[model samples]
Target: MQPDWALLLLVANVSTLTVCMVLKLPQIITVIAAKNARGLSVRSLLLELTGFLVFLTYQTYYEYPLITYLEYPVLIVQDAILLMCVLFYNGNIGTALPYTVLFILCWRLITIHRLIIDLAMNLSTFISALSKFAQLQSLWKTCDSGQVSALTWGFAIYTICARIFTTLMTTQDTAVLFRYAVIGVLNTWVFATIIYYRKAGKRKD
Candidate 1:
C-alpha cells in the first residue's frame, strides 16, 4: 500500500512538538526520586542548554515559521529546570547563578552580530553531540543509569526522528536536517546504553 505522505508529515510535525513539551520531565522526576544526580553529567546538560538556545536564536533570527521551532522554548525551560536539579543534588546550586548570567550574555551577544548567529548555527550540532557524549561517558564510568532517565532519552530519539521527517518534507535545510540526523543517532546510542546498564543492574540482583 502506498503511504499517505501528507498525513504522515503532519503527524510527524505535530508529534515532534508535542513530545518536546515533556521531553525532559522524565529525567527531572528520576533525579528527584533518586534524590541524587548520579550518572548524570552537568557538562551534558550545560551543552544541551547552550545548543538549544543557539538553535532557537538562529531560527528566530531568520524568522522561521512559529510551528517550525515552537518546541524549542519548552525544551529550553525544561532543560534549565533539569540542570538546576542536577546542580542542587550535587550541592553546587550556587553555581547556577553564574551560568544564568552567562546564558543571558550569550543570548544577547549572538544577536548583536549577524555573523555570530551563523557561526553559532554551525557549531550547534557539534556542541549538542558533545553533550550526548558527556552523558554517555558518565553512564559508562558509573555503569548505572541513576538519575538519567532512559524514558527521557527514548522520547528524545522519537522526537528527533519526527523532526527529521518533517524537516525533509518542508525546509530541507541541510544544516538543520544534518543536525537532527546526528543527534538522532546519539540519542539512540544514549538510550541503548541506559537500557543496557539497567538490565545489567537487574541481572545482578
Candidate 2:
C-alpha cells in the first residue's frame, strides 16, 4: 500500500474507534437524567470494564501501538461511571464507592507483573465475549431494547469492520483480524436485538 493510503487507513481506524468510545455518552446521559437504570445491566457493564482494563494493561505491558488501544481507558471510565450510576439508583451507594475503588486498585496492582498481565489478557478476552452474551440475555429477559444504546453497538460494528480491513491491508495479523471479526459478529447480534425489541415494544403500544 502507498504511504498515504496507509496513513489514511490508520486515521480512519483511529477515528472510528474514538467515535465508538464516545458513543456510550448518550446512554450515560440518559441514565443520569433519569436517575434510574431500568433497562441497564450491571453485569454487562462490569464485563465491559474488565475487558477494557485488561486490554489496556496488556498493551501497556507489551508496548503495543497506543493509538490502537487508547480508547480502552475511555471505555473503562465510561463503563465505571455507568455502573456507579446503576448502583446508586438501586440504592447500593454504600457498595458503589468501595467496589469502584477496589476495581481500579485491582487493575492497577495487576499491571505490575507481565506473567499476570498475559494471563489476564487472555481471561479478559474470554470475559468480554461472555459479557456480550450476558447483555444479550439481559435484553431477552427484560425484552427492553431501549436500555442499551443501539448507536454504541452500531459504532462498535463499524469500528471492528474498519479494523479488520485495516489490519488486512497493513499488518495481516491473523490474531487481530480474528478477534475483531468475532467482536463484529457479536456486536451485530446485539445491534439486531436492539432493533428487534424496539420494534416489538412499539407494536405493543
Candidate 3:
C-alpha cells in the first residue's frame, strides 16, 4: 500500500530541519575558531536573516501543515541564533543599527496580516538568493587562494543535497519552485568551486 502523503510530507519537513541545522555547524565553528569575523561577510549573514524571516512568515500565513509549520519557525529561530553568533564574532553587539530595528519591525509585522506575511516571504526569498550569490563569490575567491574553509564547503554540499530533495518532492509549478531555483544556483556555484579548486590548485589574483 502507498504511504500517506501527509506522512511523507511530515518526514520531509523533519529532514529539511535536520539538514538546515547540520549545515549551520560550519558557521558555528567559524565563529568559535576565528574569535572574530575578520574574514567573514556580514552581508551574507544578513541575507540569510531575510530569507529565514520570509520563510517563517510564509509558512505561518498559509498555516501550512503540522511539521512544515513547526519546521519553518524553528529554522528562522536557528538562523537568528546563528546570525547573532556572527554578530558577536564581528564585535557588533549593542549597536543601534537601523537594520536591526527594521528586522524587528518586519518580524513583528509579518505576524499581523496574511498579505504582509506574503510580502515578507517574497522579500526574504530575494534577499536570501542575493546573500547566497555573495557567499558563492566569496567561496570562489577563498578557493582560488587556497584559503577556503572546509567546514563551509561541507555545509554547502549538504545544503545542495537538501535542495535537490526539496525540489524533487515539492509539486511542480508551486511558488516554492522559485525558492528552489535560487537554491539550485547556490548548489551549482559551490559544487563548481569545489571541483575547480581541487583540480586547478590555487589561482593567483
Q: How accurate is candidate 1 locally (lDDT)?
A: 0.91
Q: For residues 72-180, could you state the per-residue lDDT of candidate 2 as single tens digits?
A: 6777777877787888887876887676787789898778788888778777767788888888998998999855778778877887787777767655755556667
Which regions in candidate 3 have their CA more than 4 angstroms from the true location?
A: 4-11, 96-99, 140-173, 194-205
For each candidate, give its TM-score against the true structure.
0.95, 0.87, 0.72
RMSD to the hidden true structure, all candidates:
2.0, 2.2, 4.0
lDDT of 3: 0.62
Q: Which lDDT tens digits does candidate 1 get at residues 1-205?
A: 1379878877877888889989999889989988899999999999999999999999889887777788999999999999999999999999999999999999999998889898998899999999999999999999988777888998999988888877777778898998999999999999999999999999999
**Model 2 clash number:** 0
Candidate 1: the clashing residue pairs are none
lDDT, residue 165, model 2: 74
**Taking the tens digit of each residue's C-alpha lDDT, what string does model 3 give over 15-111?**
7667666656665665667675543456776787777777756765666544443545655565666667767766776552676798888788788
**In model 2, where do residues sit more than 4 Å from their true spots?**
167-175
Highest TM-score model number: 1
lDDT score of model 2? 0.77
